[model samples]
Target: MSESSDRLQRRSAPKRLTADDWADAALAALAERGLAAVAVEPLAARLGTTKGSFYWHFANRDALVAAALARWEEVSTERIIRAMETAEPDPAARLGALLRGATLSVVDDPLEVRLLAAGDHPEVAAALARVTERRIGYLAHLFELLGFPAPEARHRGFFAYTSYLGHAQVAHAVPGAVPTDPAYLAAVTAALLKR
Candidate 1:
């Protein structure tokens, strides 16, 4: 083939951005700037593409939003739970790791904070409910394994989840209000796990 023809072919073949690519970009926009910023044009520009590419993958903005929320639920909640269950055998140690990780990574990971802010939307609310239930249930199971009665286990799980939510709010809304130092995090985790 001629050099010019080859160049033309390459230029005409726009990058093939997959549906997952668009979905992930939408989630990032949602996390960084909230649900309003997940619009196609904005995400297309962010991905260095055009609306045509977005439409090629998603049917509409609502579809894209649904995909983004599903991705968030899978990545943020399900994956973490799976990893915790597989990687740690001891309930106490798994709980400690979870509590410490959640506390320490608050500022660095604000997707949950962003989602909570947008929870009024139907899709966001549904996803939030599912994740909250799953997380709290898992925490409760861990507490149960640690020998707490069912009711106490459930309450502790709720408390731990709420504590993380509060800590995340402080860390995200007012930096430096919550100390994420190693010692501080360890102390907090120990306190949570204390019988």
Candidate 2:
């Protein structure tokens, strides 16, 4: 092909994967095969690229893992919280929505379970702790807004969080076991909130 033609072809080709892309692929790998599966070579293959592409964005595997965890935190916790707050003005409704949203499992996004399983890693542990605290704190605040005392709110928040975690674990272990019906979820929310 002529020089101009070659240049046009190259320009039209897909752009190189960004660090975010690599991190996303790493998170997918982590979800599919646990933490150990998040390696440079495998993720590169998963992305239909090479290690060179990964190395361009990350210094090493650990950096990639950290990036993936950070991305998870942003999407799973921060963004969810932001969306929840904006979606509902009432604290009680927001809390119910959060619980319902959390219980609905997304097949492609099972990173929470994977991360909890791999929580021994310092990065995973730290991320898990941050997310757990953030979620529980928000829940507690909602409970307080609903007229629960500070200690009682915190206790209810912890109970709600543990129930969530347990439900997630059970859902993962036994598909279709965790009820996703709106009525069931409403019942769960009402029982948890004691409303």
Index of the highest-TM-score prediction: 2
Please write out the lDDT profile of model 1 over residues 1-195, one tens digit for every residue: 999999999999877899889989998888889989999988999999989988888899999999888888888888889999899998988998998887887778788899999999999999999989999999999999989899999999999999999999988899889987788878876776788
Residue pairs in clash, model 2: none
Lowest lDDT 10-residue stretch of candidate 2: 103-112
Which runs in model 2 stand beyond 4 Å of their true positions?
Answer: 1-11, 106-108
Local distance difference test scores for all models = 0.89, 0.87
* Residue pair clashes in candidate 1: none
lDDT assessment of candidate 1: 0.89
